[model samples]
Structures are given as C-alpha cells and as structure tokens.
Target chain A: MATVRIVITLKPGVLDAQGQAVHQGLRALGYETVSGVRVGKCIEITVPDQTARDDIDAMCERFLANPLIEEWRIERDQDRDGTGRSRVPVLPRSQGS
Target chain B: MMRFGIVIFPASNCDRDCVHVLRTVLGHDVEEVWHEAGSLDGVDAVVLPGGFAYGDYLRAGAVAARAPVMTAVRAFARAGGPVLGVCNGFQILLEAGLLPGAMLRNDVLRFRCTTVHVRVESTQTPFTRSLRDGQVLRMPIAHGEGNYFAPGAMLAAIEEAGQVVFRYCDAQGRVLPDANPNGSIRNVAGVCNPAGNVVGLMPHPERASEELLGSDDGRLLFESAVMWLETRKRSLVTPLRGSR
Candidate 1:
C-alpha cells in the first residue's frame, strides 16, 4: 500500500491564531528564543500502489485543502516496512529542536 | 406567501430558528431541506442556517460546501433566486465559491457572542432592499471564524463592485475598529454576489427577528426579501406595463 500525506497550512499573510497562542505559551514557559509559530493539519490516506499522483493532487485541491487561504504539500510513502519507520513529521521543528 | 427553504446539514442547529422566524414571525411558508437533498424544488428562497456541519472538520463549512444540496443551491443562485447564508452558512457559501473571500479565525482568537450594530452599505441586493443606505441594525454574532479575508486585488474588486451589503459600525453609523467584532477586513459584516442575488453574512438575523429577542431589526431583512420577490413576480407578469 502507498500512503499519501497532505499537509495544509495557512498561506502567507494570513493570521494563525492557534499558532500564535502556542507561541505565547512557549514564551511563557521560558522559551523566549521562539520567534514565531504557524499551525497546520495533515491528512494521510492509503491507496493502491498504482494510485496516480494526479488523483492525490485532485483530492488535495478539491477537498483536502482550500486554495484560497491555504497551501498544501504532499509526501508519498510508497513502501511500509515492518519496522514502521516511514512516518514523516507533519509540522516543522522550532529553532532548538 | 412566498415559500422559504432552510437547508439543514447534519450539525445545523439554527434551522428551526430560521423556520420560526420565517413561518411564525413573518407568516411565510417554510420548508426544511436536508443537505443531501438533490434539489430545492418549490422553494422561492433559500437559507443556509448556522451550525458546525460535519463537526467543522478540516475547516468551518469545508465539508458541507461539497454537499449535494449545494449544487442545487448554486443553480438557484445562478438563476437569480435570493439565497441568504447566515453565520456558518456564510462560511459554507465562501467554501462553495458562491461568495468571494474566505473566513479566518477571529483576530482576537476568541469566539465572540454579542449584539453588534451593522450599517447597511448597499440596498441593491435582494436581502437589503427594505433597508436604507447607512441604516444601522442591531444583530447578534456568535462565531470564532467569522473574520473575513480577501486578497488585495480581490478585495479591491469587491469594493469597486459595491457588493458589500453591511459594515460593522458604531450606533451612530461610524465604521471604526472598535465596532469590528471579529476583525473582518474593512469591517465587512455581509456581502452579496456580483449579481446581488446571493448574500452571506456573519450575523444571526434569525435569532433577532423580533423585539423580544432584543431587536426586531433583523425582520427587515426578511421583509426585504419578500418585497423583492413580490416586486419580481409583478414585474414578470406585467413586463409591458413599465410601472415598476
């Protein structure tokens, strides 16, 4: 099975209130070095290995993400070994970690 | 009496409130159209009431925008039928691409539930025909994602078309930052399509349809719709009279 991951984030210049709140919380916890934060969501779908990239792109454009205020990226995990190590982090890491 | 249809999605909670206002308060015929319905048969007007459809998954109104009924709703609007979307309904209209711009989380990062004054910006649409330009109406807004946003060029185009129907304003009818309940750009509270047939607004006019609800200003909108429809019917029947 091939797993396609769609990550959706607000477009630039759009405010991310939840991310701002998280950033404030981090600062309150003494992480003053955290300059910014933006929040987004990820959706993973399992399809046959022969699933075309266009189909996945259509899903993202039609329903998975809104193009007006958001941008999306897709990552494909074509093979899943028994070790289960193909998972990708949905959000980017902050400065320290 | 004109027939009004209120589309009810799975989580829609305000459908009955709209029914009450249209059927009971305004003495009009009302029908409840489920989201899955294939058509809007027999209804003269349409209303998309407020609620967290599909649990507001993905984003507010995202899932519901693709519902089957919207196809019919889109057709209805294209045919020049009046359609009003309130609160979450407004979000769905934006998602469905029937309206311009998108809704973002409130700038204050809070769900605001309060009465606000909105000045009528235009009476050219079916929804605001009974209201005079700059008339202020008190209505309650309850939502977290009511902030309206549009790209710079699109915002300018909307403004140039005079599509804005309502603007958050002070009691004295001044548009100011303090009057903006959700930080909607330009203090816009309601807007119509370019054709002025379909309208979407963040305020819950159904909840304030009577004086007992603290304001009957919302009733004017319903009255305006009815008046528009009546005039339209008369014009169709007497096109050569040239009396309109």
Candidate 2:
C-alpha cells in the first residue's frame, strides 16, 4: 500500500525577493502570461505502522520541517479487505525496484 | 534576597542588559548562567534575554533551545518556577517546547527596529503583577522573525485562557492597525503560558528599565517578576516593600 501526499513551498522567505523582477521580465517579453506569485517548500514522508502518532509528530517538529514556517499533513495508506469499511494498512509496504 | 539567573548562550547578546535590570533596577543578585552546562546553583527565576543565538542559523532559537542547561530550565519551569524569555529568548522558549505557536519571518519580510506602545492585558498573572489591564508601556522591538502563528482553534483557546500578555498599540493604548510592522495576527506582541510561569515576547523590556537609557516603562516587567518571586518563593527569601 502507498500513502501519497504533497507538501509544496517556495524555499525560504528570501528566495522570492526577485518575484517582482521576474514578473516584469515576463511582461517585457510579451509573455503577459503571469500574475501574482509566491513560493514555499514541499516534502513527502512515510512512517511505520507501529509508530505512534505522538512520536511521528515529534519527529516532524524536530526534523522533517522547520517549525517556523512549514506546514504539513499526514495521510495513512488504507487497504480494504473487500469490506464496506476502510482500514489503515501496515506501513513500510514491500515494494520491488 | 531572591537570586535570579540570566541564561546565556553563544549568540545571546542581551545577558548584560538583563543582569543590569535585575540587579540595579529590580534589586536582585542576578547570575549569568551559561548554556554549555547546567548549574543554576542558587537562582529563584530564570530569564532568557534577547539575542541572535546561533546567528539564528537554523530556525531562531532552534539550536540554542537544545542546550544542556535547558533541561534543568525545563524541569524548573515544569515544577512551577518562573521563566521569562524576551526576543530571541522567546524563540528559544517556543523551540524548547515550553510555549505553543511559532515565529516566522516578518510578514513584511524585513527586520523591524522601532519603539512601540503596548497594553498590558492581565495583572492577575504572576508575570504581570505590577501591571493593570489596559496600562500602556513603550517598549523597543527588534526582530526579523516575530510573526506569531497558531491554528484558529488554538488561538481562540489561548485567548479564552487569558494567555495574551501584550499587544502593539497606539499612544492611547488602543491596538493600532498601522503599527503592526510584521502583520502579526491580532497585533500580538507578547504572550505567556496558560499558567503564566513561562513568558515570551519580541520586545526588549530590560533595555527600557532605566530613565537615563531611554524609557523606564519596561522596568515594570522586571518589577512584576520580582514581585511574583517574592510571593511564590517566600521560603527562599523574605519579602520587602520598597525599603525599610
């Protein structure tokens, strides 16, 4: 099973200081195909099935993302047993390269 | 005779200011405690002064918050001791997991250096014993990452719990829309834990402790903390009102 999510950002705050310059360049080139733009960062994580939510949360706070400006969400892979309900599957799923 | 400890780190630049305020203005023998080790041998309260610890190389206060002495500081604060963190110190407190919310780059994307008025929100908390509701004080704020952020539910909960300590304001003490340099939510400049033992702010209160230096309004914060220590640590030191 695979749990998929997307975390997107434009690097850090200072990374986009040239935003205005780029926007102006686009206008001068006759592209006229751009509007307001901002940036952020993105990350993808896979956690263990036995891992507690609190432990994973702590890991996120300490390492995966900068606590100051980064925001993230977690989604667990669900596998159905041919039933009407969905249940989280075991993580670290076996996959072949 | 309350002994206070002013926490010092490699990038802490305001330790002396805190010491001067504690000893000269608030009348306490303030000790400079280093972060490389834990030895708060004789201290009633811990003050984390403002500075760019670790050059804020990572997140502001992220690296310094994990220093050895923070263990003891955390233990002490958890056991109902008072801990005050100003500016970079505030960043440390948040990174140390002592306080909620996080600070990011100022919304305006610039380092702000200016003096602003603030209104004291609560005098009942130990950290605000010397202040009254709506009392205004002018304090200096200098920071690049002072925008405070938390989720909506948590923000409401913090407000409902009376944790707000100060806000950017006009001369009349009304929070000014134009005065919010960082576009901080709700014009918040400072806040305390629900228990009121841990405080964090973006301004330099100790720098305003003396009339000769500049404004003396910030002295009230040191006074309030000292008063709180006297009331809470009666076993360690006898209380004094002004002088004999």
Q: Show where candidate 2 strays beyond 4 Å.
A: A1-58, A64-69, A72-97, B235-244
Q: What share of the true interface contacts does each candidate keep?
A: 0.71, 0.10
The best candidate by lDDT is 1
C-alpha lDDT (0 to 100) for residue B241 of candidate 2:
19
lDDT of 2 by residue, B88-125 (tens): 99999988878877776777666899898888876655
Q: Which CAPRI level is candidate 2?
A: incorrect
Model 1 spans > 4 angstroms off: A78-97, B236-244
**What are the per-model numbers of colliding residue pairs?**
0, 6
TM-score each candidate. Answer: 0.92, 0.76
Residues A1-97 of candidate 2 have per-residue lDDT tens digits of: 2433334343444234235455667789887777855554444456556766577567667855555456555544443344522455556758898
What docking grade applies to model 1?
medium
lDDT per residue (tens digit) for residues B58-112 in model 1: 9999999999999999999888889999999999999999999999999998999
